[model samples]
Target: MANYIHVPDEAPAVPKIDVTVDERDYRSGALKLIKELRPSWKPSEVKVKFFTDGITNKLLGCYVGAVMQDVVLVRIYGNKTELLVDRENEVKSFRVLHAHRCAPRLYCTFNNGLCYEFLQGTALEPEHIRSQPVFRLIARQLAKYHAIHAHNGWVPQSDLWLKMGKYFALIPKYLKDPEQNTRLSTEVPSPQCLREELVWLQQSLSVLGSPVVLCHNDLLCKNIIYNQGAGNVKFIDYEYAGYNYQAYDIGNHFNEFAGLNEVDYSHYPDRAFQLQWLSSYLEAYKEHKGQGSEVTDGEVEVLYVQVNRFALASHFFWGLWALIQAKFSTIDFDFLG
Candidate 1:
C-alpha cells in the first residue's frame, strides 16, 4: 500500500514488431516473434501455452522455464475489436500505467497483438474478491491507479460518451441470421429504447461532479491478479482503460461483483460492504494525493450516490458492447446472453 514510485516524466516507446500472429496457428508466428525478442532462446524449445480466461482476445504464454515465472504474454486482438477499441490510445494508456509502476512492462507490439510480461498470480474469482485482505489490496491498488496523471498538462476528458456512441453506431440493426435477429429483439430493449437510455445517462450522470481520472474502466474479477505471498494485486488488460468519471470506475467494479459467466445481481456488494470498500479507497486515495489518510462519512455518502447511479451506465455500456461482440467475435462466450 506504500508504493512510492513517481510517474516517469515521459512514457518510453514500446518497440513494435511488424508481424501479425494469426490466432488459428499462433504457435509458428509467436515463435518467430520470440526469436526476435529473445535471440538466445531456441524456437524449438519455447513452450507455447494458450490461455482461455479472456473473452475478447486470444492469449498465449511463451516461455522455456516454469509456467508463469518467466513468460511473455502474446495477446492476439479479437475479431473486429479494433472498431470497438481505440488501439493507439490503449497502447498509450498501457505505457502510462507501466511508467507509474501500475502495470506490467509492455515488451512490444506486433501487427495485430501485444506481447508483455506475465504476472505469476491467481486470477480472482467472485467468491475470492468478497473475502478479506484481497478486497482491500484491490481498493488501494485502484486508488494508486487513479492517482496517475498521464495527460502531462492537458485537462482530462473521458471517452465514455464518445466510445458509447461508436459502439451504438457499429451495432447492426439486424443480424445476418434471422434467428439471431429474433433473439436480439426478445433478449434486449429496442435500439430506440437503448438510444434513449444513453441520452438519459449522459444527462443524469454528467451533473454529479465526479472527478475525472484515469480509470481501468474494466475491473472484472478475472482482470485482477492476486499474488498471495507478495500480498498485493495487479490489474491486467488496458484495452478499455482511459480517463473517466471516478465514480464510473468504482461503479463498474461494483457491477462486476455479480460475476460474468453467471451474472446474479444478488451477489452485488451490500451497503455495509460498499461503505467499507469506499472508505478504504478514499483513505488510500487521500494518501496518494498528499492529503491525510482520513475520510468523512459525508464524503463516503456522496461517492456512494454517484457510484450507484453510474453503475447503471456500466450495465448499459457492456450490454451494447456484448451486442456487437455477438455478431462479430469468434469467441465461444455467449455475449448476447
Candidate 2:
C-alpha cells in the first residue's frame, strides 16, 4: 500500500495592517457624523463620552437630555456611525414582543475595517443578565419573532455564510490539534446530517405556509434590554438581521443562554426552569400567530440540533478568524490559546 497521508497546510503568516485613527480622530469623526445626521443638533450641547476596549467596534456616548429623556447612544468607528433612535418605527412583524425601531442609522466603515452601531441603554454585564427576568421574556419574544415570520422569501443572500464556511475550514489546522477539532466537531451533527434535516425542514416549512420575516441573527444577552416603563424586552443591533429559518432565531437565543458561565446558570436553578422559559416563549409565540396549542417535543429536539450546529459553526468560524488575526500580530497566540 502506498503510504499517503493528508497533511494540513501550515498556518500562513499574515501581514500587519496599519491603524490610522487615534482617540482624537475617532471623537472628531463621531461628532461630525452625528452633526451631519442631525444638522440642527448642536455638538456643544450634547455630551459625548468615549468607550475604548470594545471587542468589535468603538463607541461614543451621545446623550441628548433636552430634546428627549432617553439617550441617543452614538456608536463611532474610524469614519462610520450606527444611530439607534427611540420610539420610532414599530417593529411590524412580531406583535407579541415590544420593540422600538430607529431610522437613518448612520453605518460607516472605518479604514481599519470596523463597523459601528449607535444603540441606546447601558451596557449589560453577566450579573445584570442573570438578575433580570429578561431570559424568559426574550425566549417568548423570540418565539413570537420566529412564529410570525415563517417563510415569505427573504433569506440571507449575503456572502457572509460562505465566508463563514471558509473560515471554519481553517480552524482545525490553525489550532494544530486535530483531536480537539474532532471532539468539538462531534458535538454537533455532521454536515450530511444537517443537509438531510434541512431537506425535511424545507418540506415542513413549505407545508406550514408562513411568511418569512426579518430575524435578528445576533440576539445574545447583550443585545437584549429590559425597558422598565414599557414592561417589555427590546432587541438591538440589527446588523445581522435578515430572513432566516424561524427555528434558527429561537435556537440561537437558547445557545446564547447556554453560553453563559456556571455562575450565570446558577440563577435559573434546574433544567425545568429553562424548560419553563422555553414553554412560556412558545405559548406567547403561538398566541401571537394564532396557531398551535402546544410546542411538540419533536420540535424541541430539532431546535436543539439546530442550536448545536450553529454553536459549533460559530466556534469553528471564530477560531479561524483568531488564527488570521494572530498571523498579522493583530492577535497573539496567547489570545488564541
Candidate 3:
C-alpha cells in the first residue's frame, strides 16, 4: 500500500476544536461546538436535527432560525471506526476535493468527530438515480472526481488490497456471542474461504489495467445529494474516499443500485444502461483530460469488463467490512445477515 500522507503544509490546516463529542449525548457536545462556530446565536434558538441517512456515523445538523441556512454538520465517528478508517487520509481527501470545487467546505475537526457545511439537496433514492439526467450527472461528477490527482508527484495507487488485508486481520476469528457465532458459521463463508476469495480478487483485478485515481470508494445512493433546482449533485461523506481503481469505484456504485435497506441484485443496471453510463463517464473523463470526447466501442467494452469484475471485489470488500462491524458497531443493523 502507498503511504498515506497528510495534506501538504501549504494547504490551510483544518481547525481542531479540541472537544470530544459523546455520541449518546451528542446534543450537549454538538451545542458546545456550535457555540464556538456560531457564537452569536442563542443556544436556546439553535436547532439541532439528527440526520438518519447515515449508517456508519451519527450526523447532526446544527443551525439557528428557519430555512436551515448556514447549517454545520457534526459527524460522530462510529464505534471502533478508527480501526478501519484513517482520519488523516479522510481529512486530506476532503480538503483536496473541496479545493477542486467538487465538495462542500469542511469547517473543522473535533476530538471524535468533524464538522462541515451542510449541502442543500435531497439524498437520492435508488429509483431517482436510475432515471435519465440524474444518472448522467452522477457519472460526470464521478468522472470529475476521479480526475483529481492532488498529491503532487505521488503516483496514484490503490490501498484497496492493503485495506482488505487489514480488515481481515481485525475481524475476530469467531463471534463472542454463541448464537451469533452459530449464525456466522452457517451463513457466512469460512474465513479461509474468504481469504481465498480475496487472493483470487487481487490476482484477477490487478491485471484489469484500471487506472488508479482518487475514488469515493463508497458511492451508495444516499451519499449523493442532488440539487434539482441547481441541476447538480454533490457526494458527501469522505470516510472511505482515497486512491483506488477507477473501475472499482464505478462497479461499487452499480452494486449499490440494489439499495441499502432492502438489497436486491436484480436492480443492478443492465448492460445497455451500463454502456450508456460508462460512455458518459468516458466522454467526460476524456474531455477533462483535454482529449477528444469521442469514445470507441472497444474502449467501452474493455471498461465494462473491468468494472463488472471489480464489482465482485466490491462485494467481497463490504462483506468483510460488515462482519467486522457486526463485531463492534453499536448501530442496530443486521451486518452478518
Local lDDT at 152 for model 2: 38
Against the true structure, what is each candidate's TM-score?
Answer: 0.96, 0.58, 0.97
- For candidate 3, the per-residue lDDT at 51 reads 87
Look at candidate 3 and give me any clashing residue pairs: none
lDDT score for candidate 1 against the true structure? 0.89
Candidate 1, clashing residue pairs? none
lDDT of 3: 0.90
Q: Could you tell me which residue pairs clash in candidate 2?
A: 80-108, 81-106, 82-118, 140-281, 151-211, 151-212, 152-212
Question: Which TM-score value belongs to model 2?
Answer: 0.58
Per-residue C-alpha lDDT of model 3 across residues 149-202, encoded as one tens digit per residue = 646657767889999999999877788989999999898888899899899999
Count clashing residue pairs per candidate: 0, 7, 0
* lDDT comparing candidate 2 with the true structure: 0.46
The global C-alpha lDDT for each of the candidates, from Candidate 1 onward, is 0.89, 0.46, 0.90
Query: lDDT rank, highest first?
Result: 3, 1, 2
lDDT tens digits, residues 93-174, model 1?
7888888888998989999999999988999999988789988999999999888754444567777898899899977777
Winner by lDDT: 3
Ranking by TM-score, best first?
Answer: 3, 1, 2
What is the per-residue lDDT of model 2 for residues 268-309, given as tens digits with 9 covering 90 to 100? 223455456556666777787787657877655554445444
